[model samples]
Target: VERMESISRVNSSDHVAACQRSNVIISLIDEKLKYRDSRAKDFSAKCQGLKFLPFVTKPAGFSLNWKGNYFKMATMFSAAELYTVEHQDVVCLLKPILNENSPSFKGCGSISLAVKDFLGLIRKPTINLVLNQLKEVANYCEDITLYQENITNACYKFLLEAMTQNEANKVMITAELKDCSFILVENTYVDAAKVAFHLNFEAAPYIYPLPNKYKNNFRELFESVGVKRTFAVEDFAKVLESIRQDSESKQLTENNFQLCRRIISEGIWG
Candidate 1:
């Protein structure tokens, strides 16, 4: 019985030591798994082109500093995904950025269109105030991680519509008097593809040509609207260019341009 008891004690000590060894192995495995996951996440983020704060990045093709080409020619794009919970927040976050030169934003078409729609709804100081407030909110959203979970396409569309409709009061067109001058400056000779993109026309999937029939009418339309016919004191081009320098002149030109765009978009002029 004494011998049996001694042997049992030795066996129990072996079992305890074996258990300690097993625990050490398990701990090593867990640590290795954690390290692997962290590496994978970093790799995924890099592959997705996730930047620090601003997600916008132009293509590598535009690296060459050529003077003649436009800055947005290479297409600086943003690929921000919005979540349902975060969609409204994201729209709210981006409103100020969207509002600034919105009609000219070649990056995000939806945001630009939404801003245009919002301005159509909300007019003057009130819209201007909200836009100003949006500027404050736009300063945030840096904490948002690129690969957010639970994001759906529907949520994104919903956010855009809601934010757009939120400010639905239209602006007042107080004055519409005699004549406003505008310049159709075409310094850079770009093809139809580039023109379609700059104008934000339906050039996706395929760039359909502007039908030779409409091409002649296009020139006639502008001429009918009236370009300055040569002035003695200031050159015709310089007079139009001068209007662009003043804030009021700038606004008037924009208003006229918008009316022209509307006529074309609505097919009313055609």
Candidate 2:
């Protein structure tokens, strides 16, 4: 009877929390829709003949490179220095209390209630459930790339409308337009907050230097798997051949190929 009561209370609390989160998400969606509608109206008014180009559903050779020049919308605070988390100093203050090894700690040390609940939910085979939920939230968010792309497309449409036949031919090549396609370029700049996240949360714990002889081979092997590139078992075989005195592939079985790949991966991570 008591266990049932306790479970009922817990379920009730969860229901309330879930409702609150849903409400917040709904509110966000409403705001986003309102803002997007306003932007669309404004854009339509300015560029009456502009037609939006649909992006490829499955884009190939995608990569995020931080070293690039890109335009940014102006704001009161610098986007580069903007902090996503609020009240960061409070976390610093509670660090000592949260530290398990600290002498000041007296109570049973465990992960925060939120993190514990999250880890519990994720530990189950709930990846699809999690992804669907994330996708719902993601639908409300504006992709910055698409936003900039719309502006650029609108500008080009305006230019095309104003252009003389010869000028348009020189610029766009109307007859050869079917053959002309764009390679999507994604420009990115890592901000201070994201940099800190990468350093403190996402970085490898340790990195050992590669030997002088293997360093160049390792770089080549890594780059071989990059955009518009291919890497085969033979590529790594060449590396092995260079390393071995005999330069033979007698023991290079499927298992050995996997093992060699793992070794290369670990060396790269380190």
Candidate 1: which stretches are off by over 4 Å?
Answer: 1-84, 88-130, 133-168, 171-270
lDDT of 2 by residue, 1-270 (tens): 122123224334453332233233324434545565555334322221211111111113212121111211110111111111121111111111111111122111222333222212112212222222222222322343553333223322322332333454334323222222211122222111111111111111111122233233223321221211322334434444444433264656565455445536633332
Q: Which stretches of candidate 2 lie over 4 Å from their true place?
A: 4-122, 143-270
| lDDT of candidate 1 over 71-104, digit per residue (tens) | 2232211122211122222233222121111123
lDDT of 2: 0.26
Q: What C-alpha lDDT do the candidate models reach, one value each?
A: 0.27, 0.26
Query: Model 1: clashing residue pairs?
Result: 121-168, 121-169, 121-170, 122-169, 123-171
Q: Best lDDT goes to which candidate?
A: 1
How many pairs of residues collide in model 1? Answer: 5
Sum up the clashes in candidate 2: 1
